[model samples]
Target chain A: MKQDVVIRTVCRLIVPFIQIFALYVIIHGASGTGGGFQGGVIFASAIILIGIAFGLPDALQRISEKTNTLLSCTGLYIYAGIGILCIIFGGNFLGYSFIPLPLDSAATRGLMAEIVEIGIGITVMAVMTSIFYDIAVKEDM
Target chain B: MIWEFNFALFLFLILCAIAAITVRNLLSAVVILSVYSLIMAVLWAEMNAVDVSFTEAAVGAGITTLLFIATLSRTTRRSED
Candidate 1:
């Protein structure tokens, strides 16, 4: 479990940047190529990198099982809530423009899409991290 | 898409794939599989499938490799078969 000081230092320095970039990818996904899935994976990778460099116990302490489970569900609700809202507004499911937003049709659609992407990103990040934790954590430990 | 670059990448890709399957060490195979994923990501980007390329790079090369390594920790490093 002993890690080099150099590895720990590098991981500490790089994790924040990785997280910021993940946010950027999620937010910009509406207009660009990267989306919720990619952003979420990137975020999870950052945590995984920390786990690898530090230790599983440290990483789990940072993001506990309860927090992870809550996050995954919260993301799904955000995504489905939007879709159901559209239906309640007399449009088909996920009909973003149907929501009674003050903005114009295209703008409303864009905004809804962004929210959905964020939700997706959150769910993905939590799930992927949890998957890593499950696979990596030792039974005896 | 330059033919020469594509050809070189494909060559490397094939080699990586072969090595990944044939390598006796599970860790080496996992590393080689990661290399294969990276080359495939580049190929996807070259073909204008940037989204797919990004996914390949993130999930395929990044998370999958880490998961494989994590699994390796619980088991033997060498493959008996």
Candidate 2:
């Protein structure tokens, strides 16, 4: 059997740490300036690393192009819904202060920020994965 | 002025970009692009954007290089000279 045939133990060590670090950036964006886009890219990077060390065909087995496409569309919908809910409540779009959630106080702003970050993460990760798939399959689109 | 740093990064970006374009060697081009990213990352950090630097390192250094190699392998090694 080939040494690289099995999933490398090094990947198990590295991937989790990268993911947790990405989350740290996403949640702590208020003062630090890192946000959903950056965190999402990093998260996608981790998955991509696995894709590289393993193989494209195997990676696709887990992430599939269809799933990536679905996530890409769903992320935008989530972001748009936040704005729609704000407007429905008689507030300006993205006026996150008006979001009617269980949370109260300035925490609401944090809540809105975090949600938007998550949306960004979803879109970036999904889109990036699709980009990899596209290039891998060599489908001109 | 921020222009100073911008100019430095721009210079590296341009030179590497030209190398990637003009040279027939695909691998060298990819390597030069990695250097370009490193320079750009440094510029971002100088501008007090640690987050952008982090992202640039991950995307530019890690993923972009990987993509290039993978794509390059799918094609031929030698380019039309």
Candidate 3:
């Protein structure tokens, strides 16, 4: 695919802003309307925009299959690990207050929720990008 | 909720939905579907469902349209029936 200067330039200019907004959505999810899933989808859309403007090879180089797989796994681990940590602390699964934190119970729960949101954001971003790559790439036999 | 705005949006929504299904060109269909999604997002927001509106804007209009376009590129552009 021939790269157009207009599309490429616009994509480069906007990708950063898109990613930042996605992070904002994820971080503000506890108190606001957006959440991890929405943020992750937005982030993935940025990568997809890059792919559309710069070609699949360039996008893949930026985020290779191996890295994508690793990220998805790591996000899931973070989510489950926190849940198990709460269990070990004699609280129900994902009971954020049970974790031995220096902060008050409400603060601890809030912090844990934030971490969970981050985990979810990471997983969704990686998985969505992976899905796009799988669908977009042509199989050369 | 403004009834006039809601009525106009619903009219456009129906038109887009019909156009999306009836259009023979797959690309046009995808685009119309994206437009439909955009209008739906506005309606969701008008109804005070901001979260759903955001999701519709992002996933429905943005990612889903791109995916459909990608799929169209991989297949034929015109529909047989």
**Strongest candidate by TM-score:** 1
**DockQ values for all predictions?**
0.96, 0.53, 0.89
CAPRI tier for the interface of model 2? medium
Report the error of model 3 at residue B8, Å. 0.7
**Whole-model lDDT values for every prediction:** 0.96, 0.79, 0.93
In terms of lDDT, the poorest run of 10 residues in model 3 chain A is A132-141
Stretches of candidate 3 exceeding 4 Å from the true structure:
A139-141
Rate residue A39 of model 1 by lDDT. 99
* Displacement of the residue B36 alpha carbon in candidate 1, Å: 0.3
Encode model 2's per-residue lDDT on B1-81: one tens digit a residue.
478768877888889878877877888888888888888888788888887897898789877987897688678877877
lDDT of 3 by residue, A19-48 (tens): 999999999988899999999999999999
- DockQ leader: 1
Residue clash pairs of candidate 3: none
